[model samples]
Target: MASSGTPSLLQRVSGSMVVFLGLLSVLTSVRCDEQVPVIMWTSEGISLPRQPPPTAGHIVGHQQLASYLEKALNIGPRNVVLFLQDKMSIEDFTMYGGAFGNKQDGVFPNLEEALQSSSSSLVLPAVSWPASNAVIGQLQDQLETSPLYMDPETLSQLRLNASSPALLVFRLPYGTGSDLLSAKEILSGNDEVIGQVMSIMKSQSVPYTAIYTGLQPSRKEAASLSVEAGLGGGRSLLQARGTHRDRWRDRERQQRVKEKPGVYPPVEFKEDDRTCMLLWAKGLTVSILRNNRWEEHDLTPSTFGEGVSPKLHGSNCDKSKGRLVLNYENVLGHRSFKLIFVMSERHYKVSARRWFTLDAVELEYDGTKARFNGSRNIYAPAEYSYRCKSVTSFRWPLLIPRSSKDPANQWRVSFDDFQIQGFNLKGSEFSYASDCAGFFSPGIWMGLLTSLLMVLVLTYGLHMIMQLLTMDRFDDPKGPGISVPQTE
Candidate 1:
């Protein structure tokens, strides 16, 4: 269909295409920085009633120790660099830079490689004073301010541009460091740092743990500080600044944490597989029971949450004579576990108000189970259904059991859902951070359920009416007409 006047396209390949190819050959390339292996120790001064921590406690000391050694012994400075102290070079003293270089002097690569060979940087600087207006003025004149410190308030913001696989170093300064390092007199102004530190640590990662150390004037001086001050062993001995020896010990513990399979709790699960439970004041017995049996279980949830599930597990005991007790440790909410019990030989009349005991592991009452779902629900999965309920503890509806003449019937009383939560740090998998679909507001869910129920009822009623109408319209003239039956 081409017109005769059209030119042959093959002969007219655009000269513009040729020009474009030439520009493609001239494109430039840029290189990205190579990442390096490192350990960054973030430091902060912990706030107790007294002053600050010594070396952010021992754990971080260990991490610093490991990073220190890795930089020294790794046989390559290009491999690992502790970014905190610019002067640090496989040392055990001073700041991380070469300050403690003697610790790794002979062990690590040459001094130059350790310094210049770093293709990447890892920071592990201990925190001193909050880089507040006061402290910033002091540091700004000396060392270059770290990017995190660009914002003057960053130090006050305890949780800032933090690094990962990161060690948070909390300070427990003795009176000396404060007087020596701090710009303020009495350093009482720095107390805000402690309050900020605690507020942030609680909601951070499970791997996120704290190490607290202190440096103080003297033992009696610290003891005089008082219990409300948050001192340990109630003395000033623990509140003193760490010397060189303290650093070494901290390093030792840290090395074990790394080389050894499980030293302390990292973000990962460790040997203890420790599971912490938030128990309530009412569940002292339950806490005692759990503590006694701690080793037997991997991680027992010592706390109860808002709602109880339909299926429940665990054991409870009724210590009080007429009172029904439910074990909840630090757990706030009314919903507790259900008790499942079998019928005994006696045909006792069970009252909903009366207390009965159900013993799974411990003893608790059956009817005593609180409705956690009224305002909140305590969620329990299927695996924890064993202690869901026990009957001997609480007064529940009575079910007739076999008499002496009859065979024994193995009966089970179940509390379908008992509201409780435990530390399941297995990451996702129904652990601390569950991806399970969330429930709607109780009122909203109730409305939805009611609407669906009404729909079903209406459909059922309409079906019956339609059938009756059909029968009436097609009734057999010779036979009796179909009659409506009472709806049950």
Candidate 2:
């Protein structure tokens, strides 16, 4: 009886545990389905609808939202509405109390009241959010603003029409309790709540801009949501969250390029109408060691001319020997760099190809210099042999030491689409430059020989198998062979 009672007791405990876990899961799921509040203000009044909240991942970015509004509102292509999304934290409000005011939750309502009191013209409060105030002030001051949100065309159209654009502000609830609807659901134009909001805007019949300011979903949540939805676009939600750093880097690179004066003019060496050698580059940049990191500085003709004009010379025009000298100044502060290219023609008997090589590259920076010597062949077809035949990263590191404290402080040079033409007699287009001695090195030849030997062995084995005849002595057993008459 004791043993039976023990088994029964254990069974009851296990069942109860399962029941508790099931209930806990159900409650957790219910909590995740929290509702989000969406408010839209129009000339008529304000409308807040009770609808299911959108999942955090499905939220469309500011640009996509603006595009949708433009089409639905029938705003002309020239006219535009400036959309801004501001993310704020509790600490920001506390730290910038003077700029944001004491009431954090009432910030959106305050903006609405201010807009309502104003006439057709949209008048932002002087003490509103930092981003909002700065944009409005820039517009009022006629300063340069990003054309992505506010372009000159849009502003000009507004001035011509003499009509004020409407301003809509949305204050999203903070925290994970409520989730924003996905872009798909909102764009479908089927959601009751979204449709009602659009209806309100259409009824106003005025060009409008919207501002969504509040705490955004956490990075982890946004990334996961973006993955689950499989969004793809130049400005998809995934890219906004995942590739934010990449975008920032690209922008920085563009800014640096803009600061560059220009590119080097194309230089050609001609021998009796037949051009012997031609050199040009889309852009040239040098990497200098600054603050223990490498930073790129552009080298252009303007800077080069300031010191010594670039020189092009050659012994003959038969794609044999040539030299190029480039001198520049003020590349990085008072520092400057010079590059010399030694060119020579080489023939490959194995490949039956004629190409030119960058025999050596001499780099001089500041008072230090280094020279890299070797046969760096240019590989390309006979037609386009004027270019580098081999693909190179185009970044060559110089051993010149910049810092006495650190031996790793070295300079480097990079070329963007550097092209050399007229190296070959029949060459019309640019070819590639080889950074290596030859395409077929000893190791590569060894690989080719081994593969050939394997193929020969395989062929011999197949031949032997084919030569062998089937045995006619297949078991004299069986019975006597039965013969039939050919006529029958």
Candidate 3:
């Protein structure tokens, strides 16, 4: 309360103080926010000898790379924009990769041409820099003759923008000129392009990245056995050896049984019942081979601009009785190959039985739904593990039908992303359903709004009636009055 001139002065002073305190609180809050721990960003790059092989792993397969990135950058794949670079041959590039291969094709161009079209940074050729060196020399010479060249201004801006965490993939894609260093000699080379690549990155002023995917070691295994690797016609070496051994053992067993028939009743036995089946990921594309015709399932929509490849997921097959099954049709020229992978998804093919079913595909061990994308890549590797259904090593036993024309080519499926979720007492994946929250939660909000509208309508009607009655008594020219009430 204000008493007089003095009180008024106090009030004015207090009001100014309140405003100052509020501003100070806000500034302090902002200062505190800025003081929180920040991530120390670093940039690095990877240089591989050859173009990476195609990965049959599914969308979840990216998680393996993501894991490494997370460890290096403290950021996941979804949060970072990775720049993957490599060189490919003309034919292989266009046929396998969606990117255009030759400059003559006109539709696609080299890095220099691409820069021109996109209005991005220009790329210049640099001298060979050894991989061991931190930066390259003669950077100034590089800027003058590059097919696409970036000015000093553009380089500075890009460097600042790339200061955040990211990953870089470089390839000494050029053939060793005349040097014949095999894949085994991947890390060797004094004049390899990797050095130049690093130097160019520094001059451009982009943030640094770390080596992620590389030509370090192969995770795939090769299946090998002695009996003349053959086509549809080959010797059954394993079965033959087993049969011979059985015959020799039987002769001895029979003699004993004949001599001791009285001691023991003739023993009877039954054959063990077990089988194996093929199971791919659910919704995965399948190619059925019949009469030289192939029908594929789950075709990608053309509107997507690029098509995805068939994903290799965990198979949910009959695991109790026999070996797993697959055909060599997918192989271009090889009869047998190794499969190395991690068990992203694992199940009993059923809740209890070994016969795989759709139910297995729908649930994770913890009952979460998995989202699988259909795509392929070069650097990604299938995770390796010891689960019965995974491709863990190069040497695996695959049994094919004696007759290629056998009927019923049905493939069952279950899968894990190798990096995300799979394999448990009851398998399931963790799925994010944020969109559903808005659509579903809106119904409750709408209901509350409707209830509020109803209350407002009732209150307005009563207010309108009271206002009309008062107006009639006060403003009407001829209106009845309560004289008795006034006298009282």
Candidate 4:
């Protein structure tokens, strides 16, 4: 007989291990891109190092903020793809900085420097300084162009992942009022950044964002920006911090309290009188205490006047606690101004100023309970079994103005302003308990039928195979069966 020549079990196992490692090396050897594509635009000529009179440290710099964003978004080091606007050339910009340098890192200068050693600055348009409109328009144009608009590697990853591009504009306004580039200038110019961005979002279907970073909240400007973002189905983040002194004090107190034992702050919002409502032309102001802090929400025009009828935007029920957390906001408004945010009363301070929580009105019917935040007459439909908690703040005295000089009065209430909750009166009407739903379509039915048919066919095929295997191939062993019976 021929000698057995097969390899031993150990040799076979070693071969398979080598093959697996070789395949893994081939799979992982290719360079995979992990960078996030970020098109950045910052206002030029604004002294990033300038110090404010009241604040000890300088205002937060754009470059520093950008660095924080990179870390927040998980962008890889040395892999942040940047866009050089205003005809910036690589020679004019630096990926590195030093002592004599501009004290800015990860920044690109739009204009070329006269001397390689001298400081570089961004080139502005002839029309004005920090023309946000022009920058945004040019960005839109670049996005429409070829993939060369971004780093080659980053573009490859974008194509592979199939992600739409985004914009991040950082502004430290150089001028005041009309000269400043902001969302307020929407209709002022055809090519204005806000308008153009909104058009691009609608026409090209892209994401556009304007990040406002400052030391204080510019309420009016922030509101306008928020409106712009809402129209475009995007986002607006105001990263403004409180007064420097206040922030420092908060940090210190938090640390001290955490370090000390048996020394704790009191919860003040738990009191019944803590919750209060302030009526103003802007909207209804609801104040509540939470975690030793005063939190306020303004139910503005978009929610109450000339907007969608007040209704339950969404709700969450906890059967175990018999409690429901309802989210109320204008149909078209931003989420920041949720009319009702919490149920359990709490209080917190702002800059050492105490503010109380607005108490919720409770109502019970047929063993069902409901609580409404603030004193408002708006109620959810009874069909929803939403035993709405009525607002205790609404009273006859509030209707009569305290003084003629005062702008706000209870008489300001109207159908448009008063009705803010949804109520279903018709018992026959049906609605979704949750925001999501499912449906059975024709395609689904067709697929199910096809599957059943395939299963039946497979079962029949298996049965036929078994029957064939059991059948006698030649004359059966019946001839042998006869002899076996005699022996038995």
Candidate 5:
């Protein structure tokens, strides 16, 4: 009985183990999810009151504030203005303002003194309201030109104020994650929020300055009064603006992709048209030898804008003369690269085919042009019966002459899955015969011989069977008087 129950007991033990492991994994995943939310600063804050203070003039968002600082403070090219919102906790202040006091004490007595002593060079400044419309208009104009430009609807929603804007400035080094390191220095401070904000700024490569407001609830009525005499705000307005700009750039890129030529139907060209020849490839790729390996660059309409053109002035449809030239301003960091295809008609039996002979491939680097002229041919059927959907591919190597300078290196170019259509065709669509070898392969010949041999073997086997005759023996013991009659 013990032996019979051993397998069942082991099965239950294994099942229980799996269940425990699954529960443990679930708990671990939940803990990871909970840790994902960290303290981060953003541009979001309460809107300014509509009622203007006696000393206030015009209300503006952080963007306008940054612009005003740029002009008023004469901010250098390397310097930027970053803003922080008012009414932040002590920990938040310590993180942005830089490390001050021991963790055990946890008290900020003189914020101004601490800010001055901080590594980030924090400044507390009370910016008086600009009463001049010209100044306000100029600031607004600068905001419009910025990559983080706000829409007109949001601009109209901005309220006017008579109170001066309170600002806390951090004059830190202008490199990636410069301010984040200041926050990180404090062992007990929460640097996650600032880390997230700095990541956004660093990715966009945008310079920024921060304005941290130290406003309190008791001073809400007196909006124009400065907080703490010199204490700065703690929020990041540029972080949110950078995110918005990233989305805008994404939309523009998607629009450009939609407008690319090959995404839509091919343009039609008249048959026997002499003015323009319709010759296009789905893509043009150039391969360059780098670090003992080849690196490929695919040229698109965006990269080589309107650079693919055919030389049709001297091209004659009747004479089978055509030339395609591709000029790219930049390829693989080279100054320029030019590829020319000299095309003509080749007659095979009763059919004529369009053929492109590679004339010259040149690469311009450091003001010197390296030209490679090779005898390579690409051909397709000339008749329109071959549909444009059919594509032909060609790949070849351009070996540098051994006698010439760089005999050790060889350059290769591959033209893959492209069509050369509209030579003397009715439409710009490419037409080509499918690449196929006629029924003369060695495999086909072998199959035919094998089938013939099997048929001959079967015929001989049947002939031999027909030649054999069976002997008949008659029993004459019982029936003595049996007479056999034979008929011819």
Candidate 6:
């Protein structure tokens, strides 16, 4: 009886402890679902800390914009994710950001999708972006003077999530030609819309949709912004030389050739327009095939610097063939870094005619090979350059995909935000160059000089040989003319 009674008492205590733990878990889960406030702004939009209001429609200086953003990011305990909207033009943005079906219709849809899918407390609906001045002021007033509330269940749900204040800022647009617009012009207005966005954020509820700016960046600005966003632009081949090609002149020349052409034989190498690629590598070996032979370029602080590039100017890759094979190998354990392919044409309006098909593209290093089946048809917005109402020029990354499971083969590159698909490799071995060169013809100037020197030396050597082989001989020496005597 005593033993049985002791066992019964022990079971009772254990059961009580179990009940206590289960109750504690329920309370903990309740706490976990609570939501936190977030502030998201598109690159097409801008946000300023509440202060004495400034003149309406007044463009904010770029320095002021950058300073405000930096302060917002560092000042509070909040989460910030900057949506680099103007980083890439509309077409490129779709190609890069649309793979996951995040972008639909236009820029705002993309932003809304991202916010909806995130764990943030609020979602801002898409509206006419770059809203009028009156709209901006009204939105700002509400955000600054609103008392936001959350329901009990919604608040309970927030308990399971981490809460923090967040601020997001977008990049400014770049215009074309001498009409270059300042960052202030693009990022300045729409304050009221931004304020309304803040109010929605404070509301701690799901927004119906996101605001749309409909303000697509120009081609030139897109390129400049891409580099600024760390997506593609870097020390370009043009920048390396401190000189640039005159696109207008090149365009006129091409037009003349085309007008009187019989299958305009793939524009000769001397006449090829500028197309380039940027490569980043340190202590690596890079080579390009010229005349069916590999020409090596070493990457170092002196020759190729920390990054090197080989600009494809019609010679390295035959224009008639429309394909190029770039060979790379890793030596001395220096791995490759990043590569960006830039394509440009004259006139933002004439950008449609340029196209190249990358076929059977392969990168082999460290006994591992990655193959990409490239084609001109694969690039999005299948419209011709001339037919394109908007600018048609853009840049793309040339790197191995990080994962094999990417949808639509579009993989977001980690080295920079540049997106690419199709090329995937698991091994690292090839070393790449960081310097950009226009003419990839191996041994260019050196080869020319060497050949000339060889010809001169050969000519002199032959003359000496001929003089030695033929001699004027006579049986008797004539004092007037000294000549070699023959033993005959």
Best by lDDT: 2
Model 2: residues >4 Å from true position, as ranges?
A: 1-265, 271-274, 301-319, 333-336, 372-378, 381-383, 386-409, 425-488
Candidate 6 structure, TM-score to reference: 0.21
TM-score of candidate 4 against the unseen true structure: 0.17
Model 5 per-residue lDDT at 398: 38
TM-score of every candidate = 0.18, 0.28, 0.24, 0.17, 0.29, 0.21
- Greater-TM-score candidate between 1 and 5: 5
Better of 2 and 5 by TM-score: 5
| Decoy 2 TM-score against native | 0.28
RMSD of each: 29.5, 29.4, 29.0, 31.0, 30.0, 25.8
Give the RMSD in angstroms, all C-alphas superposed, for model 3.
29.0
Best candidate (score: TM-score): 5
Candidate 2 clash figure, as a count: 14
lDDT tens string, model 1, 312-388? 21211122211122222222221222222211111235532322221122122111111111101122331221122
1-488 per-residue lDDT for model 3 (tens digits): 01111222223433212212212223322321111110111223321122111121111122232232334333211112212122211222222212222334222122222122221111101111111111110111111111112332343344434433322223332232344333213322312333444345656645443221111111111112111221111245235434765456546655664686432211111111111122222122323355676654331221011222222222222212111212222231222211212122233443543211111111111101111111111011111111122211112212121122211122212221112211111111122211112333657998989999999999999999878743334544577654546565
Which 10-residue span in candidate 6 carries the lowest summed lDDT?
A: 385-394
lDDT of 5 at 110: 28
lDDT of 4 by residue, 1-488 (tens): 00011212113332212212211222232211110011222222111221111111122232333333433223211111222222111111121111123434312121111111111111111111111212332332333211123332333344221154443332222112454333222212212333333233234323222221121122234333333322122122111123465456547755675687644321101011111111112244443435665455454433333323333222221211112212243322222223332222212354343222222432211111223434132212222222211222333221222233221221122111221212221211222221111255557888999999999999999998888755344454647433334565
The reply for model 6, stretches above 4 Å from the true place, is 1-57, 61-64, 77-251, 256-397, 400-488
TM match of model 3 to true structure: 0.24
The order by descending TM-score is: 5, 2, 3, 6, 1, 4
Off by over 4 Å in 1: 1-109, 112-451, 458-488
Candidate 4, lDDT over the whole model: 0.26
Worst lDDT window (10 residues) for model 5?
Answer: 32-41
Tens-digit per-residue lDDT, 312-331, candidate 2: 31123444566554545456
